[model samples]
Target: MLPKSILEHTLVLDIETVSAAASYAELSPTMQKLWALKAEALQRRLAEEEKMTAADYYPEKAGIYAEFGKIVCITVGVFTKNEEGQYKLRLKSFYGDDEKVLLQDFSAMLSKYFQRRGQQYVCGHNIKEFDMPYICRRMIVQGLPLPAPLQIYGKKPWELHHFLDSMTLWKFGDYKAYTSLKLLCGLFGIPTPKDDIDGSQVGRSYWEDGDLDRIEVYCKKDVFATAQVLLRFMLEDPLALIFESADG
Candidate 1:
C-alpha cells in the first residue's frame, strides 16, 4: 500500500468529558427531571438485573452524552517536520472546568488552521459520530459561532473531506461493528503510553479526584494512538514518524 500521508495536513484530536454536575444530587430540579427521562431510555436498553433509576446511573453514564456532560479536555496533535528532518506530532490542548472558554479557544485554533491550510483535515477515532458532533453540539449549547469546518449545515457529503476517522478507515466500508483504537494499536503492534487511566474512568478522575492534568495526559495519548493507527492504515512505519509533544 502507498504511504499516503493523511497526517501531513491533519489535526489529530481527542477529548475528555465529565458529568455536568459532580453528582445526581447536585443537579437542578429541571435537569434532574430531564435526566430521569433520559435515563428511562438508557435503562430500557439494559438487562433486568442491570436496571436502576436514572440517578443511580447518572455518575457512570451522564458524561458520555453531550447534553449531560461537558468537555474537560481537548488535546490536538499534528504531524510536523522537525529540525532533524524527522516527522513529529506537535500537540496542543484546550481544557479545564470552564467549558465555554475551552471551546472558544479550540474554535479559534480550528479557525486559524482552516485559514492557514485552507481545508486541512481533522482526524480522530469515532470523530464523525462522537467527537465532531459532540463538539458541534456543545458549541451550539454554549452559543459559540461554528467554525467553517464545523459548519456542515447544508453541505453535501462530498464537500466534507476534511474529516477523517481511524476507526472508520479500519471498517473498510463494512460498518458491521465498532473497533477500539487500543485494539487496533494492539493488532498493528504500535506501542501506546496509556497505562494510567482509560475513558471509563475519566468522569471519576475529573469530578471526584479533580485531576485535569491526568485527564489531559490520557487525551494526549489517545491523540497519539489515533495518529499511529492512521499511519498503519497507510502502511507506513509509525516509529519513523517520531512522536513529539509541542505543548510548550
Candidate 2:
C-alpha cells in the first residue's frame, strides 16, 4: 500500500494523442517517406497475425508512436483533503489543435506548480512504457525542456520514485502478462472510462469529427479512472466520482 504522504504528492494524468497529420497523404514528403519506413517494420511483425497493408494500419496505429503523432489533450488530477478528511480529486486539462501550445502549457504547469513540491510523483496507467516517454519525445521534437519528473535518463531503477505506473504496480515484478486499465477498473468495481470513446477512436474523433471537446471530456474521464485505480492500489477506498468545471 502507498503511504498517505505519497498519495497526497501524486499527480494523476492521462493523455489523448492522434497522428500528426489527418491522413497519411497530408504528411510532408520527408515525413511520408519516414512513415513508410516505420510502416514497413511494423508490417513485418504483424504479417502473420493480420493481413492489412501499412496504409490501412497507419491511422489506427500511428498515434501510439510519438514520432508520428501529437498529443491533443493532457488531463491532470490532484487529490485534496476536505475539512471532513475526505479526499476529492481536482482535475485540469490543457488541450487544443496546437500541439506546441498545449505541450508548453503542460510543461509550465509542472515546472511552476508540481516541481516546487519536492519529490512529487506523476502516476498513470501504462505510463512508464507509453505516456511518459511519448510526452518526453514530443517535448524534445518541439524543442521544449524536459520536465523535472520526466528526466529519468541516468537514474537507476531504484531511484525512480517520482514515476508511478498502475500497470507496473499490478505486475509486482511479474512482467509476463499485460492488463488494460478498463479490465482493472472492472475488477475493482470502478466505472470504466471507455464507455464514451476508447483510445482506438481518438484519432478519428480529432481528425474527422473535429470534436476536440469530446476528446477533452474523454481524456478527463481517463484521468479520474486512473486516479481511482491508484487509490485502490494504495488500499484506500476508491471513489467513483467525477468532478466538473464550475462553468459546466
Candidate 3:
C-alpha cells in the first residue's frame, strides 16, 4: 500500500497521441519509407494472420509508437487535501493541434510545479513502460529539455522514487503478466475510461474527425481512473472520492 504522504504528492496523468500526419499519403517521403519498413517488421510478426497492406494498419497502430506519432493531449490530475482532510483529484489538460506548442506547455508546467519538489511523483497506469518514455522521447523529438523528474538516464532501478506506476504496484515484482488500466478498473469495480473512445480509436478521432476535445475528455477520464486505481491499491474507498476539473 502507498503511504498517505506519497499519495498526497502524486500527480496522475494520461496522454493521447496520434500519427504525425493524418494519413500515410500525407507523410514525407522519408517518413513514408520508414513507416513502410516498420509496418513490414510488424507484419512479419503476424504472419499467421490474414495479410493487410502497411497503409491499412498505419493509422490504427502507429500512434502507440512514439517514434511514429506525436502527442495531442496530456491530461493531468493531482490529489489535493480538502478541508475535511480527505483528498480529491483536480484535473487539467494541455492540448493543441501543434505538438511542439503543447509539449512546451506541458514541459513548462512540470518545471514550474512538479520538478521543484523533491519527493513529488508522477503516477499513471503502465507509465513506466509507455507514457513516461513516450513523453521523454517526444520532448526530445521536439527539441525540448527533459524535465528533472523525467531525466532518469543513469539512475539505478531502486533509486526511482519519484515515479509511481499502478501497474508496477499490481505486479508485486512479478514482471511477466501485463494488465490494462481498463481491465484493472473493471476488476477493482472502478469505472472504465473507454465508454466513449479507447486508445485504438484516438488516431481516427484526431485525423478523421478533428476532435481534440473528445480525445482530451477521454484522456482526462483515464487520468481520473488511474488515480482511482491507485487509491484502490492503497486500500482506500475509491468510490468515496470525486474529481473536479481544475478549470472549474
Q: Rank order by lDDT, top first?
A: 3, 2, 1
Candidate 3's TM-score: 0.96
TM-scores for candidates 1 onward, in order: 0.94, 0.93, 0.96
Q: Which candidate leads in lDDT? A: 3
lDDT (Cα atoms) of all candidates against the true structure: 0.84, 0.86, 0.88
lDDT of 3 by residue, 96-199 (tens): 99989998888888888887445899999888889999999999998999988889888887777677888899999999999899999999899899999999
Clashes of 3: 0
Once superposed on the true structure, which residue ranges of model 1 sit more than 4 Å away at CA?
1-5, 83-85, 116-119
lDDT (Cα, tens digit) per residue for candidate 2, span 1-248: 77768877888989999998888888888988888888878778665768466567779789999999999999999888777777788889999999899999899889887774346888999988899889999999999998777787877767776778999999999999999999999999998999999999999999999999999999988988988888888788887344544213
Could you tell me how far off, in angstroms, the CA of residue 41 lies in candidate 3 after the best superposition? 1.1
The most accurate candidate by TM-score is 3
Q: Which stretches of model 2 miss by more than 4 angstroms?
A: 47-49, 116-118, 240-248
